[model samples]
Target: MNPFLLQTEVRLASKLIMPLKLQLRQLSLKRFRLQLRQLKQTLDCT
Candidate 1:
């Protein structure tokens, strides 16, 4: 139960988690772009 050790653990966890969060964000953005493209195509067809 050391404070310094807890801080280090938090920092390490954040470092590891940040990239995964960024990747998830990127994936969602890509998915959104695909949906927009499909919507545009459907609109054009109509």
Candidate 2:
């Protein structure tokens, strides 16, 4: 395998992965916030 081709493949894979990682992080944060809100509501009710 050619070194240049391998390098390009790695760069492309990283470019694709960066946004996916960011989206996952954002989704997890949203879920965490939702959980905290639910917890607060339950505490208030109790």
Candidate 3:
């Protein structure tokens, strides 16, 4: 295989992965916020 082709493929794969990584991070952050809200609600009730 050509080295240049391999490098390009890697670059493309990384480019594709970047957005997926960002989306996953955003999703986890949203989930954490929801959990924090629930914890606050439970604490308030107590």
Candidate 4:
């Protein structure tokens, strides 16, 4: 196995993983916001 090729593969995986992580974080944040809104509305109604 070539060291350079291995390094390149690792870099590519890292790049892909970063975006996936970011997307997961964004989705979690959005979900939290939606839940918060629902909770607030329920509280207001009560």
Q: Can you write out model 4's per-residue Cα lDDT over 1-46, one digit (the tens) per residue? A: 9999999999999999999999999999999999999999999999
Please provide, for model 3 over 6-46, each residue's C-alpha lDDT reduced to its tens digit, 9 standing for 90 to 100. 99999999999999999999999999999999999999999
Please state the error at residue 34 of candidate 2 in Å: 0.1
Residue-pair clashes per candidate: 0, 0, 0, 0
> What RMSD does model 2 have?
0.4
Model 1, position 1, has a per-residue lDDT of 100
- Off-target runs (Cα >4 Å) in candidate 1 are none
- TM-score for candidate 4: 0.82
lDDT of 3: 1.00
2 or 4, which is superior by TM-score?
2
In model 3, which regions exceed 4 Å deviation?
A: none
Error of 1 at 16 (Å): 0.3
lDDT of each: 1.00, 1.00, 1.00, 0.99
Superposition TM-score, candidate 2 onto the true structure: 0.97
